[model samples]
Target: MPDHQQRIAYLLARYADKTCSREELDELFSAIGQGDGPEGLEQLLEEIWQARHPAPEIDYEAVYRQIKPAVPVRKTIPLKRIAIAASLLLLAGTAYWLLPSKRTGKQATVLIQPAQRRILPATNKAVLTLSDGTTVPLDSTGKQLIQQGNVAIRQQNGQLLYASQPTDGNIHYNKLTTPRGGQFRLVLPDGTKVWLNSASMLRYPTTFSGKERVVELDGQGYFEIAANAQQPFKVKVRDMEVLVLGTDFDVMAYGDENSVNTTLLTGSILVKEGSTKQLLQPGQQAVIDNQDHQLTVKTADIRKVTAWKNGMFVFNDMALPAILREVARWYDVDIVYKASPGAELYGGGIGRDLQLADVLALLEGNGFNHFGIEGRKVIVLP
Candidate 1:
């Protein structure tokens, strides 16, 4: 092994033995961040995990809380990339190593068993509701759904495509909705692309005929509008409206959430909540409070905001309840908290492709909480 690889091995051995100092932990995280080939390191870690013997249980939550400030800064890495690195550490079983309790000054032991039931992650699936209340299920399988004059609606390569030329005066609308454990992509008549997250809906006209193209959104969706200087694009979500000529942005208007967030990625957008309006620049996010309807703009965490679109979950010091809500949505499970989870904050990255049991295992290994899977419910134990 190279000198750096040897150093990582040494650190891993010390980490597994619960002998690494706080400085060594920081060094280990920094080394992992700087590694050129994460796959090799992952393999090496797996080998070490397999070769290791049974040891006393450890409290990973306390250790993580202690070393959070030492987590290496890697702004250039994508959240999914960080997920690979973080998942490896969490899965290797070394992350749960011994740490003395702050209060008792004695090592705490926590054993988190694997979940009994298996629940898979969300997939590309949606339902298309026509203007006349007709509904059609859609998936990756390519098929033509309907034809209206010069326009045809079809599904191909997991995307709902609208193929049309300029039609007559008659206008028709369609609504695409995804269920709890589902997501989908769409191509509008004007070549605009849309990605709908889990439990989201998008409603739009089949063909653009007016000076302004308008669409209604009920949940989360990422849009890349087709450029048409003559016809500006507009998205209406409840009382708020987003107006743009040609831009890339994401809107999260889930009813359960306390606020509607609009994050701008490219170009400018005018957000209108009734008479009040705020023009947002790229890399900025507009937050509208649901109670007071107050609108505010601030710098956005681009990677964390967009991680869902790239099949990853990035938690940046998110509350435990909020994290469980996300887990429930993606896994299509009910979260039953038997005890108050308190105000604990969690930070990490994990792939969205993992099964429910695997995700729970990663979270439970933190040693702050225990979880049990019963049917379609995820129980948070005391």
Candidate 2:
């Protein structure tokens, strides 16, 4: 073997064993990108794939290409550039990179059917409730800016932007709400950006003049607060409050959940629940128990926590009910459980843009339960 091929083969082996460091992973991809043909690292991966699965009936590359036709065969492949393509191709069976989920060493597969009912994914649709109680329907189609006093609110390229003139006296507040099966993005008066998930609402002032910029949030929201050392940004969600000078974080405080979760992605935050306060560092999560009023902070998987904002539904050993709750909110459907799959944990990543049928098919393919879709309702069978 050539020296370069030998190095590539060694890197591929290290990758297969999951022992490749960050620098090694980058080098491996760079080397792969510099080379061509399946005679090198590709063959090594094929051997690893075959060794992992004794079934000779399955041809990895063939099946991968069949599932994802858009991914053309490249002699020289860059891992970052071809990551999604590789993930899609590898997600069909064992050794999947873009899997729906797996838990307790079990993988979840979504069975595709020609006749399954398809419910399209949610879109950027919401309603803006002004201070005067006037509700304005918002969608990606609208281009005009709605003016209220000195503030200009507009939906440009699917994002709601707030540009306001200087004001001294009035602090008019408005609410942005996304109903079931909808989502929206907003740029606050302070240039802070917020992405509201389905069945979520954000209440904020038209201008920030006070000592602190405070907002109220219901359901789930991902925020990128504009830096203001003097004026701390605070988010009041249910019984918990997240205070930060400027940070990127995700807050999940749905009323039905037992606890309120605030996951900080960047910067720091002070999470206060009742009298108990907890400080969170970057990549840390604060969980507030609603019943006991206890607060706890722990390390968080930032990717899984912020997946929804990145247009993916990532489940990390998540319960079926919890997953269904998200499906219910995003797809805007009612879930009637005829049989309970107790304590079953799932792990996987599915595209949030997929149709309802596609998601349900994955659950049904597991053979643990059957699902029936009637209108906007989902019936889970034993």
Candidate 3:
């Protein structure tokens, strides 16, 4: 909406175009230095600077323009892309398979055919921060099984599982934390499974505290609460509280975000922020704002909302800056754009198990853009 946001859209559109000149690249770097760039934009500048010069073999700019009109950037993206690549390792550090080689045509084509990707790398992992402020990193490590009170918990593939029965007067408390670049899944003692996104934290009793199961969550999470009419599962996110009588839904309450969204898949929920209260049913979403109690409800698509838990990054009508923020985390890479933000709000796509390069390629398919990756970070330029 703002000029800066529009500029960011344009910058992302031409990020990978190799024909962007040195002066053009410097202009981008200067614009970003003006503090209008995306969150991690600066970190990606070096990578983007690399692409400012032309590549040897092909003219990347020419290729970009050809695809630009075909995939027009819009105010609101129409088709969504599911871009999460499956983990190269399934679980316990087991390598699933190797990426397809660049081999193509002639002798290579005759030698082997490209195999379909089965499962992509799952960007799921979390840490448990004790109430004492000491955080316990929960990865594929930890003993096979750990017992705390009546809870039988274990870690499988970076997910923490709590298998315990409801008991009276349970007092221990624990928090599940998803770090800046990780996500995780867990089944509570009561069978309410939760998928936590990056930079999130979930706090709960080692056992259900009272008749109602209460938990505190920061950032975003998807929940599938076990059906128990007697005991409603309640989640406290920032100023809002979501109470459900056993339902499947997703909650996005990241602190940095202006509004918290609660999307229901099956069943219903009551979301309350301040004096404001909203009801949501299946295929419905409720938005509660932090600044003003502005609330909006509309038809919901749970699939797009819960795609992350299912191992995909689904974006519908998302801006390039918005999309890249998520990408920076999952791919463990940073991004910088060199063109204008008004170029387009990228229509999202699904890249099942796509490599960092492949994922960027799809975005580049819409415009003249090239990416430079060093270590875990990436930069895009035009």
* Off by more than 4 A, model 3: 1-122, 132-134, 141-143, 165-170, 368-370, 374-376
- Tens-digit lDDT string for candidate 1 (1-382): 8787789889867765545654676677777666365557656654555566433443445434332332354655444434433433454532222222111222223223345445789988899998889888987774766776667887877889898677777788899999999999999999999999998999999999879999999989999999999999999999999999999999999998889999999999999998999999999999999999999999998876887887777676677687788888888889988877645455556667777777776566543666777778888876
lDDT by residue for model 3 (1-382), tens: 4565456435533434333333443444345434333544433432333344322433334333322222223323211110000110111111111111121211111111133211124355677764456666777555567666566778777678777766656577888877666778888878888988877888887776557999998888889998888889999987788999988889888765667889999898998887878888799999887788688898876656776665556555666566666667666555655544334444334443456555554554444344555455555654
Per-residue lDDT of 217 in model 2: 99
Residue-wise C-alpha lDDT for candidate 2, range 1-382, written one tens digit per residue:
7787678667656655444554665565465455353454565555544555344445445444432322323545544324423432243442222222322323334333445467787899999999999999988788877999888888887789999579858889999999999999999998999999999999999999879999999999999999999999999986778999988999998887888899998899999888888889999999888788788888998878887887777776777788889999999989888888546565545667668877776655533666777778777766
Q: Go through the candidates in order and give each one's C-alpha lDDT.
A: 0.75, 0.74, 0.59
Cα displacement (angstroms), candidate 2, residue 264, comes to 0.7
Question: For each predicted model, how many residue pairs clash, with residues at least 3 apart or on different chains?
Answer: 0, 6, 39
lDDT of 2 at 365: 54
TM-score of each model, in listed order: 0.77, 0.78, 0.64
Best by TM-score: 2
Poorest 10 consecutive residues by lDDT, candidate 2: 94-103
The per-residue C-alpha lDDT of model 2 at residue 21 equals 53
Show model 2 residue runs off by greater than 4 Å: 1-39, 42-116
lDDT: the better of candidates 1 and 2: 1
